[model samples]
Target chain A: MAVQEAKRANRLKSGKLVNKLVNEYWEDLINAKKTGKKVVYTTGLPIGPFMAAQDMAWIHGEGYGARVAARHEEKEPQTFAENKGFNRELCSYARTQMGCAMFAELGVPDDLNPGPIATEIPAPDAIVTCYPGCSTGPQWDWAIERVFGKKIPWFNVVIPYHMGRNGSTYMKGEEFEENVKYVVRQFEDLIKFLEVVSGKPYNWDKFQELMGVTKKVGKLRMEAMELCKAKPAPASFFDWSIQIAPVNYLTAWPGTVEAMQAVKDEVQERLDNGVSAVPNEKYRIFWEGIMNWNKLGWMADKFASYDATVVAGRYTHMAFWHEPDTIDPEHPLRGIAINHLECQLNLGYPITEERMMTLSKDYSIDGIVFHGARTCRSFSRSHFLLAENLNKKMGIQSTSFEGDMVDDSFYKEELVNTRIEALIESLEAQKSRG
Target chain B: MTSKSDRSSFYTMGVDSGSLTGKAVIIDGNRQIVSHSVKQLGFVSQKAVMMAIDDALEKAGLALEDITYTVSTGYGRKRLEIAGKNLTEISCHAKGANYLYPEVKTVIDIGGQDSKVIAVDPSGNVKNFAMNDKCAAGTGQFLEVLARALDVELTEIGALSLQSDADIKISSMCTTFAESEVISLVAEGHTTVDILSGMHKAISGRMKGLVGRVGMQQPVMMTGGGAKNIGLVKALEKTLGVSIFIPDEPQIIGALGAALFANDFATGIRKKVEEEQDLDKSRVPAKDCASCSVQNFQLNKN
Candidate 1:
């Protein structure tokens, strides 16, 4: 009953509100003097399963007071004096992350107000990182040392490339078991360290309960996958993706089972009614790059007249299935670790190709669409090859469109529409041959 | 000409002495050894060539005398005094990617000064390649400059980007504008972590634009030092929506491929010599130098 109340309370917290609170919690930690609490800092990508896993791990394990610093999302305001001396031809990720670090180091208050930055989170006591899968992860660690004038102890969990695939490679019974075993071992060690630091007993029962929730959530996810396969496809890939967030964030929490149950029951009921999540299937194209500021409807409406449904996409299913099923309760952190390693962004190109092919084949996709986002190279690097190969290999027509995830200027409707039209025609011709 | 019997077991070397680095590959008839030694290019290219050759021989556990033939490549190829032949970097990279992964059809190499997108056949032959050597946008130099501006080491960029929480906007595409933007952000009190994330996104975005032009193929391997950057790899994956393969040692792919070519070229030469010997009895002595009838004959046949 208490859990239900907690879930209800959580439900009332909108994403924006939660983000604000998280921001405030960080601010409090940054301002507060050392309370002898051990704070471990970890980095994350913005959109992948690993990010959710890290969030859950921190929230559940250390609470909101934990000094969690994302590599860089903060923008430092530029003064006219400094602007004159800055170079114009630098990579943007470096600029942003470095800017944020400088901002934090100066102890400058938020430029918006005359007070300290909202999130004055203190320097991390220790750093946990995944290796060089992304440029920002390593760079941020360097920035921390440069700005803070100290080197934090760093530990890493290596994610192999084999975990990104779907079939025998990733879901192999023994391999999955071994993966779980490895993660559990790591978690046990982490717990021991935490126990020593906190001067408290590790909550074995809490961990077990969390594992149970994870198993339930995993089962519910399978059901959701089935729902995705439902005749006519139950909902928009965008909607389905959003609905799965709770399952991702709360996987190891007590609320997860109920959240998964609620989501599953809701989806199942919709499936039974033969109702579609998004009634209009305009131009069903695969979306690339995190959906433009969650403005999926913008893209959906663009192809609405053409009956596009966005049958499959990297931002949706590609990111979702990247995580393995969490069945074992003994080592909960292992499941989180797997989720971290299995993120689409973390796996290098070979595994990405395999996953793209799998999603295309499984979803009966019509065409491959790539977003030539201006801000990201990791996701943009080999899209052209992927598109060309998919066309030749799978007979699925493909096209690359230009757009930024945040900046609207990069998204040109006319240019994108023309390309989309050509792609659709090509896909239609291929479909006719079948 | 080297006799077929004597050259059958002779080792050959291919030195791809590039602007940013030097590579030497030694082929011992049946096996190949690739040794890559990276150093700054000096006024004279011979020093670079010698260094690369020595490195290759050391790696192969063979002496310099064991190498019977040498092929050189890259911009400095012509300057290598010991080279028997010079090849282009494009051919060498294609050959390298094909040698490492026989199934690879496309090679995306992000080198220090330039980025190249190559399309090749399964047999390691280059079909077509588009290069962005003129610009720094999609090359490793772009990242290096960004690293300096951010005050972070180049090696740590990839691991650091994994920490990004927000998608900080990088308004500039030009390297100069981008650097200033980073500095301004620093003055404004933004975290260095966010700026670096933005820089990676920008570079990935530029590379995506380049990759979009050639079209991608499966089993695509990333070559060059930039491949070492984990953050860029992830950014590329996010942008392309496909996974990229990084071999055990990504930086050595070009050298390895060049070495494989040495083996193939030596074998081809031996075969050619044998074929010539067999045709010696039927050889014609005289031919017109200025006006050859072969062109007319070929045209007539077509």
Candidate 2:
């Protein structure tokens, strides 16, 4: 018998643009820190445009995670953090960041040589952050306060939930308007912290201009996601995982928009020619919950084995969808506030399930693969309920397996393969019955 | 271990090669258990699987070819080349549990490395399931480690655990951590029975949380090698506040389910072939009448 090589994902023009843009920003972050230019390592913040206006460098926490995870370089940092008080139960990205911090103390692992995302990740002069209804808040707080063995100026931007107070768990109806006002106030305060850290007064024009760019990116994201509705999507969500760099870190950059446009065009080309991301795409699957980042390539190949493609996912498109009308540059901070407010993580469990159902219908998804990520309590907690509801209401087939965002030890590949293969069988059976 | 054969007429086999044990069940066309074997799994799961298969085959007075269809399941199911097909232990366990107790809507399988709770639909298909695979703290492997720590035989620990009169607790929630805790408890002069009782309760507490994840729909059937531990069963019963049912041969449930699947798969293939033959009979001359007749006879018997 002859040997057969695994088929590799085509490197699209958009993918190259995204990598170049992300790598350049990361290199600039390192250079900015070395040259005495203030660089901010942050979680989800509404200040990218503000930082871009000055010499300040901004690195998104999730963007850092994607880079390290891409190279299969998260293990050492993850272990370093786990050895410390930070449990594996914290978000995988958070732990990796913590582990990356210990490179000086725990010493850098030979493999890391401290790569673009991790080893070279400078200690944040300040970490601009907010909860946005996920585990990122506490993890970000830890990233600033304790990860470096000393506290730094950390902006804990409090975004109101349902009732526009600190406590409401669900996103409510009328409070959404007031909730935006409250979150904008927090963003305004976050700008104050940014001013103090950068020693320069905040600029409204820069902020508004960045918001306009962000709105464009958001619009493009919303539009590109609609393409998955095609029978065989032009790209899988795993491919979209690469887009997180441009989406999360370089949000308002023109190159990011250009990159996204290139993606949209390529996908259109694929649809025109009746091409698919997964060859002979027999099953269209919608993935829910956080990613199995370390095993992403393996998971994608596994889907290919069954001729299944993860056409859409909650993560790649984000949990919430908004249009141009939703993002107003005049009230930029307010619009950014509302964006986080409507984020999938902030919404209550019931709303998330409803969104999952909508996506299932929109994508014509035959199955759902919920990654029962160990660290992400909020998302992992609702999988069973979400799956049960989707099964009961939509008659959709769903399956879940335990995984960690970047930790390899948390999941067994064979176990995941069997569960997915089993799900495929169940989906086939369901279709046959219909 | 190979059990004495109750009968010698068996034509179908089910092999469950798990993380730690390889179990095989041989059933006749009537689905009666003719022979079964349970062997400790080794590094080479294939060898262990073959060992179990050959034992069952020997006890049933049969050769490998004599078995019509072999369905392999469990963790090592895919590794076995001898099996005609394979199914996940979740589906197989549900099917196996349903065969033993048809009303069973839940299956709590505490296997060597992981503990799983599955909700079974009326047709024996799994509705939803939760697993505690990442941690060995609440599984058979946990008990094995604790048994070694206590210097007690695993089989005896269960019976001895029931004899314990003292109330004891295992503080650590991790298997390795609990081993150290067990050492300290022993240094403090806890009896083997008391420590074993605590171990069972610790496992029960963990299993209880896992069962809650899937939600309980009883009557719950407990299978796998862990089901053989009476003390763990009692502990689970107490924690869950419900009576749990165990099959006569709990360890072979997975293999039994695979056997049932094999029987069904073989039967389905035969029916399809016969239907094709019937279609051929009308459109063209039958080229292979002898083979068709043999398959036709097989279909009729099924």
Candidate 3:
């Protein structure tokens, strides 16, 4: 868990504020154990606001897995899970968090330390498993409880897939309302479950206030991401990936709203001053999959070296921005269910493809980099088709490479390097012709 | 030959250090090839690359210092200390094939340990490309492994495949699985020619997938060491439904392309120097970095 600062130039100074915010968030998690605050581990959903409302500490499994990968410490834990007969094909993030639980049982091996960021992953008082997008993530929650071998209280919610109803852009009409009602009923059960765990009555009024704050945070984050639409993008997709921690993990934290505002102001100032994230940016790229957490910095510098900037990624831009303006404070749970069901990952391919096309035009993308995550089939599947559709529909050339989100062994640096170089060569040729 | 004393005479060099071979080409100011050489690579690819350059230098009656610029290409291009710049073999292969066969729209390069399909424009610019993953299923290395397994000499397998009397098919494109299948076929009293032909067909099948990724275009050219295999060429022709084009020396195409890039880079440098010499030296001018080869050098380090 040794965090190395990236050596790239023109990094946003405001990124430090978010990093500080994340560090404090982790500190709060550690202090939760000592303060007798009920700690809950959950899959990514809109449940963080509710947890905050209930005065509980939330640890998102996927967020911690990304942190593990960013520190280049996924190997020992991933291997630990694989050695115990878990298939390597399972989601790397799931395996990584699972391995952390195993380490809790049989202490971390010698020559390895959990380090500052990974230290003291408190046992969950309750588990809320929400399958917003990922099919493999629901199993992760059940597996974690078994790993601990504890009689832990847990609730699971599965949202129906987001295909457009009545020919709308996404889910709509009575069908969408029914889906929301189903998830709302599940959320009510979850609220009851949380009330028993914390020994307190559910506060709908406080929850409504937190949901409003969450909407503000999402709006600020989305506006900051949209600033990259400038000709000389003030931030690269890699920058957004690093800065995504607050929105992804700390959305309900106290300073998260202020932290997001600071980021938005900084990006706006850069856009005004014409300060590009990658100097001498020539080609703008739209990244089309999960960030290779282990190679985040390396890949950023690689693209920058070719005078190409990865301006935006759907994962970073859409993770927090689930139509912030549409969240109804009066009916917060229904709003949450609708957003979760209609999130980018849960949407049908045609809808996703349409979104990417619109973004490609809005961002003036020259090409796309489709990273096929080795362990995450949900994101990796149909990438070739998507790239082809973009090329045919928008005349945008693309390159595809195989990699894993958390597993470093699944990536071949040289292979990806060659692919990117070839892409730049094509871009250069096109520019020259014009 | 142009004398070394002539300042206007520019000689550019290119070295391509591949997985199994090293190639070098020297071109004169008029962009005509002066001399070219290829050497079998050893454990030290850098040394083999240097040897290839030395052989080309000796043939051209020139010294290394006489060359104005050098650009390296291929997998081991980065390891060459002498290269002023390095480019990926994908771009170099496309450029080389386009230069060799201007009508070629697609270039399928099967090298030592990998295969790639590149789509090129009429102007020798790469439009798109596709490469095999981290597997050696359809490459010279795979052929060598199977050659060793069949107890047949590598050079003779292509001709032996051409003489096959029975049509055969190898189901697996995985190198290890195909080798096992070859062993099983040998035990079943299958002829070596038929087995080699089947292996060639299997390789062609894998190549078809790569070609399909970047949609195939007519007037295709084949390059690299694998292109020397007549059996693979014929099998690929049948699989792709097109007549293939082959250079006289396919393995050195990447080196030729690197040499061409060196010539272009040298021309740009010369033009910049003349422009700078004509301007006011006292005034600091805005640097035009877009066309500079040094930018490519910086990119290579990353």
Candidate 4:
């Protein structure tokens, strides 16, 4: 048969709202210095509630890196950092973060900076980082600290290693309790630091209330993703990836509750109307690892051409949904500590493998796509082992491609296309055999 | 291979439009390859694809209209407007290699610009595969470049490599760097055989890593242009610790696989037609000849 025309994935109405909020957030970030609002730089931890409680404007470094990549403007910042003696092998997101800081410090022209936005990032009064088993996250923060000559207050939250041998066990007994206490102590210290920076007393009630909002958003997000368990998924992982800004960057904001509700409602309406994200969906796939920001649209179309829909991705579902109900608003800091400790990245591969198996069965996934981002070793590990176990243990097929999350140059269109098509062909052959 | 009882006059064609060349294979209903042609691709002219097709048709003494179906494969498979369907090279290679050697559990294909190792199941489905991306480190183009740098014919490098006794190592992992390394080896007075041996070893080492991704199985078959290089095949066999198998014309295996798929398509259509005819016979009354004729007419019209 002739190859069908590639169609873009259907966008949700809520996605437009997310785009607006994200733009507004960017404007607020840019104007933070002038408005005397406290701005903070943070990593990809679920600390948005804390920042929101403090009424602070925050720039999520990883999120900003994704925006720069999606805009197809990562090359300049990446090269700029490389010229400053940063190894090209470092994480592209880290490189971009460092490059932007260097550019701002060096008084580089706005046009030369080539960020997702034209404006320079407002200098943060404090930076909150974490050690969640991802070295790149903390290393980038330290590098940026050195770049700015220690002018900013840096607070690092040490999230202990929670996974046991073979990734099969979580820390148990006294060790688990001690780990939570350790992180909670750090959170208390961080609160003190934030209070000093904001020049106000810490509000326990406000923090508790924001934590409640975060829990609601996480539960709603998980419910919407659960709706994808339908045969013809209403929203693909690609659509979900696009709408993550609110949950990741604006979690405690009241607008996020509405944003996530709209997302859930839109998905429900599609299910009611018998709409499919991929028309005549032939296959359901689970994507593993970070999104290739540069190829999001292109990859969506490629999968759609084969009538395959990527229904679930562990990374895209990374809202506050890592055991959302476990977080109690009454004791917010300890719950946040548990939430941080339970992150998928901090959990070992055996745990990831188990989750993938569950995802395959739950989503009726016919295959898995393992995207090994060149720089993100955190997610790149054990892909081969996972693919083997999934195939041997569960009889699910899989395929893999190597590319960077942000660096477009690392992605080869023809190579990735061939691998995807080959996967579809193999799936079809297996179906015929049955 | 198909039995003689399965033989028929119906013909199908498979075209493989690759990076450096285009190939076409024609097969009969018996799944027997009748004729094939290969043509080199040129920058401004993709006529190689059509030319290969015409040549194969001419040799088979058939016209384009006589062919029941056409399936195209390889890098340029989609660009073939006349193909009934296009498939990835991974599937095609596995199908073709399995057809050649029914026991083949894996296929290692080294093309001009890229190389792939495909794991095949017992039923001839692609189990898994891995390929080198955006690199010419272990491909036909890499060998072609080094052969020119050594002032030797492409056809002679393989046999020459076999004659070498001293073990030389080509340390560079890139094709361009390897060429410069080869030139420097010549300046250092290394024999042509030794340098060729080093190049073969380097290419085989790279192929080993690609094969490792899919977990190589026994009864391995090697295809594509690189399969023509005897030294590379020997080196691969040694590196992978398994005996390798090669087809009579390894480069056309993808086209042959496409031809097999075309035959399957034509067979499906023939079966459906026969089934409809049987249904029509069953629906009509035996005594009512005139009514039967009318029903048959309506069925054909629909």
Candidate 5:
């Protein structure tokens, strides 16, 4: 059979992809129901599924979507209502994710969207949660229960953190295979639950085809990262990082492999041409913290003009690193689980720091710039001390900049520019003296 | 062997067991350094201290019996059993700063895992201080990571940052994000010089934030291993709009402070011992004196 027909036939057998597509298609159907029109919901990290559901829901008018996030305050609020029922000791990412969920259920006014938006978004008619190990996970479960009551459909995907980071002791060189198997099992369970809830037979062949396509796409994506390992790959860490969205969202879909194949071809062409991602290459810097979501273009342009390049960052690497080289048919679900768990943000601080140091050494960074986000205490909490230590111990120059990833108002370009100018002069002087 | 008074009057030893390195300083009473040694800390703190002490003694042309008193400071100050007294790193740093430049009012010490901004009175007393010990963002470790990211030697960071012609503003405060930003910039074809400059700016900004909290006072003295980075020093001066004074051998300030304390302690001990001897002589009874004389005669006869 031709690749397309083979994919179609395979999708028909698995039923997972068909189930997701039907779920998305069912958003419109659910919105048509008077009782389910104003749906509200909450979600956790590896937010691609939730986002996809939201996008689909918006198309179907299954009610407008709003993501709940946590705010950082010096003092914990006195009451549960005031505190939003969150643990102050938890990381900011967990706090925010949980806080958003809490606010949604309690009908608190949020800056993301004032008043009530949707009681629940329908794309994810049922949640397929992986782990409740992090503080955010349990709170997220509680928040969902509080908001939707017991009426909402949910499935748990038990992801042991030890298995994710430490790899499986039960298997060597087959850890990824084991992890993927677990994911496939969860996917199957999710499909079964959806069929029962929707009262429709999921097309198994389409699902298998989708999974097959995803497997192929996963392979190609790994190839893309490997391509970067080449001497003259035509990409930066940022390029590779941003490209992860399609890989994550479109995975297990028929179109993913083709899309990734095209990207790989382009990357190969660039590599053949011996083209570097950044042409000017004036000064190379290492970045820390979350990217400014709104001003990435602006920031990139500003730095590019100065002939300065950002060599590495946590966000970009999270997407590119730790990809499996080949797919395991026997353990497809396990692969998905490993992919989700291995993200940079999901790892603990010690591991993150070790990776950062390794990247710094590997990249030959001149200096480090730490972005201390106002909102993300999880990522920004100890950055100042990290910078100080780097400077003192390694004889490297380190500095911190304050701003939020999503919020643009916190960034003052004029103040930032002045500081940059002075810093450059200082660097120049040091070079001359040396 | 030298008499206790002679030993006390002649020499003193200072040990500073910093987080990353250990230093030992041997000085004569008259402000002349007999010898000094530095060693990077291994897993064992005591071993590092012993090695440093042995090396300093070997270099100083002195024996252990010749040393009167030893003062210790830095993170491992309390672990030094051979030292007579332990002083806080802050106090020792200030003393060292004063010894190098008596006019310095502000002292900045950047260590491996922490950075401190210290304000000193004319008498070298610490008046106020601010410290960032919670993260490695503005510390030496950040630089080490950046150096690795750039594939450059740690010592080359300062020189490279200084060579940049244009300023690259790295806006990430988190080390992870900052590294990502660097990678992105490199992909976009940014020059290493600009990136280095951006990094220097970032460090300067963090230092300025801490310095601003303490209020910048002149003459500012930059100490610690971080002070070796001229780019950082210049960046700090620019950020604070003030000149920074870097003394010779900036890393030795803490040990220098310990040495000064040792000198004072040794002198005080000598005075106390002399006073005790005088008291003992005064309290001598007549019968005891006769008996002592007889014993001395017998000893002489023997």
Candidate 6:
């Protein structure tokens, strides 16, 4: 009973609130679709603020896949796609959403009825592809078109890859400034496309208000992040990740700001009292990549067993730390341009290496855990190299374990358990000698 | 181990309840192996563990209470209530390999359920390691699956694969695909020796990749049951471009490591007594590691 009470005290209320907000947002979309309102499909980039300002529901690709998996309704769509000859080795998020698309369009069998993301997410009236040259967003858009038997209205804003050491390192330079101008021009095209689909002109005033909200959330989130630098961090990265739900799904909304503020307050209280989320926090670890969402509790418990807490990570804090570019207040699209391009997913190394080293020092991390989430190639590919760099530079050791974001079978619990236990044991030995 | 005068004799038992087999080793006070036993692990892990322990005790001429300490390891380490401590197979394998071949900086262990490569520093501490238990590829189960596909006993495969003259390329990384390819090779009139050699090459190539992940070091030692397979060892040496050192009783390495740990714990010479893992099923009081300081990362003002 006491343990249950402690868990409840440690838990954040924003998760329930975010779930409510998501359901209501989806219900609003379902109702809007009935009234002939268009839904804009997106690749779940940094386009949430823009979509919300246009009053078009964002049926984000990866977000929908996560939703289908979180709700355990992925089997129907995943099987449907495999039967239709889609390669199983493709990214899991892609496979799941494709399954969701085919299942939603054609029909689900009697025994395979799934929840909203799989069955009720209506066909996209338009697609907004935004992965620059780093990935293959165009290929996915073409596949979606092939599956749906129609060419949806396509609006793409190519986020420029970082020619410098950082993704947004050259934002202040003339070349990157011109690149931002080019992307801002494409945003103008997206605005025109939205104007055609929603049958309404661009609303600059509403977008300005949304950007103001974005600024507010960023402030609150960074404040909470600062609190995590405390010794024996007030909250684990797992807790921070749960709090990021509102920021990722309902970005630019007033509710998101409130959720973030509440999280900041809760974290501040823990910091003021010098209270750790885990009872006997020993090692401060920088978790470098995405966790297996389904095994979050299992992994957290294992870390607790080792008396370690993940202090900070890219996956948990990326959405929160996205401070919009210092562009003119009149040009809101330029801020979106900066947000889309500055993301770690859209960038390569050299920059990430520096950021990880700094955060490792700031968090006073003793070790690291880089998960190979099989579904995300963008995150998994650079892990070993990044880990090697950190080890050579900072003496911060890292170990890799394979897992999937939502697919439970792909995640071998024993394998992960043994590997992690071995890592922790090794760290303990090293620390003992040091 | 520290000095001649301080050295005293004590007995300890270590049991490794592996997935496919159970191994037990008893060490005297001089840290010499007195007796050991290896048995196939049947359905019940606890029974198999006790049977192996009894076999070792008979050879050592000792009863249960005669041993000073007992440690358990391997896949079923947690199940044996007779032991007061348990360690992961990684630590045990490293310890065992280090004891036998101290010059070895790397240990590649291919057990029944999983495989791993441990890179050890000069101090006999693991510097880095990589493991693969996600799939049957490059594991003992992979060999067993192929053995069944070829209608051959597992014990004979090592000898059979060495007689082949020409190398047959087997490109499938998936076990199921590999099995089907093996069947087709047999149907196409390929000799069992050649097919077996191809399978050994495939397994070694996969293991070589795992070893390379931890940055393969020289003087590599091979432990676990897989090291007994001559064909696989040759293939691994060929793939890794270096010969490996294998212990006499390759399968009992984990058990031997546990016994060494048990002796050290009893003598209070090595790791301080602490509640490490899920042992002490008697629900004994937890003892935190004394050498460990539970605190934040101290500011390194370099």
Chain B TM-score of every predicted model: 0.81, 0.88, 0.88, 0.88, 0.85, 0.84
Q: What's the C-alpha lDDT at position A80 in model 3?
A: 79
**Predictions' DockQ, in order:** 0.03, 0.15, 0.27, 0.40, 0.01, 0.23
Per-residue alpha-carbon lDDT of model 5 for A110-219, expressed as tens digits? 43342222223233355545442344454555555654456556656554432334533212335535555665576677656556655566555544444455567667
State the lDDT of candidate 6 residue by residue for B177-273, as single tens digits. Answer: 9999999999999999999999999889888777766778899999887998999999999989998998899889889988988887777732233
Q: Could you give the CAPRI-style class of model 3?
A: acceptable
Per-prediction TM-score: 0.48, 0.84, 0.89, 0.88, 0.45, 0.86
Worst 10 residues of 1 chain A by lDDT: A1-10
When summed lDDT is taken over every stretch of 10 residues in candidate 3 chain A, the lowest stretch is: A1-10
Number of clashes in model 2?
Answer: 1
Q: Candidate 6, residues A147-167: lDDT per residue as tens digits? A: 889878888777776555323
Residue lDDT tens for model 3, A175-294: 667777888898888899889988999988889988888788878877888888998899889888887777677876778888788888989999989888888788999998889898
TM-score of 1: 0.48
The TM-score each candidate achieves on chain A is 0.68, 0.90, 0.94, 0.94, 0.61, 0.91
Please list the C-alpha lDDT of all candidates, in the order they appear.
Answer: 0.57, 0.75, 0.82, 0.82, 0.58, 0.75
Per-model i-RMS: 21.9, 6.7, 8.0, 2.8, 22.2, 6.5
Judge the docking of candidate 6 as incorrect, acceptable, medium or high. Answer: acceptable
Error of 4 at A278 (Å): 1.4
TM-score between candidate 3 and the true structure: 0.89
Q: Which stretches of candidate 6 lie over 4 Å from their true place?
A: A1-16, A34-36, A80-87, A113-118, A132-149, A163-182, A318-321, A325-329, B1-10, B41-50, B65-68, B184-190, B268-302
Q: After superposition, how far is residue A354 of candidate 5 from its true place, in Å?
A: 4.5
Model with the higher lDDT, candidate 1 or 6: 6
The better-scoring model by lDDT among 1 and 3 is 3
lDDT string, candidate 1, A1-434, tens digits = 00001110011112222243345444434544454445555544211122222221222111110111121122232221124233322223333333444555565544432113323445555555443255555655555566667876555554444443344344344455565566547655655555554456766676666555556666665566556554456555555444444443333443445655666676676678876544533234566555554244556554543455565667556543245464356655655656555566655566677778887777667776777666556667767677767766776656566665433445555345534543554444344445
Across B1-302, the per-residue lDDT of candidate 1 in tens digits comes to 55555554678777766556666767666544534555445532567667767876887678877776677666566577676655556667777788778898778888765577776677676544555523356567777778899899989988887898778888776667777888898898888777778777877787776666566777777888788898888888888788888876666666666566667667788779887775664555444655665422211222
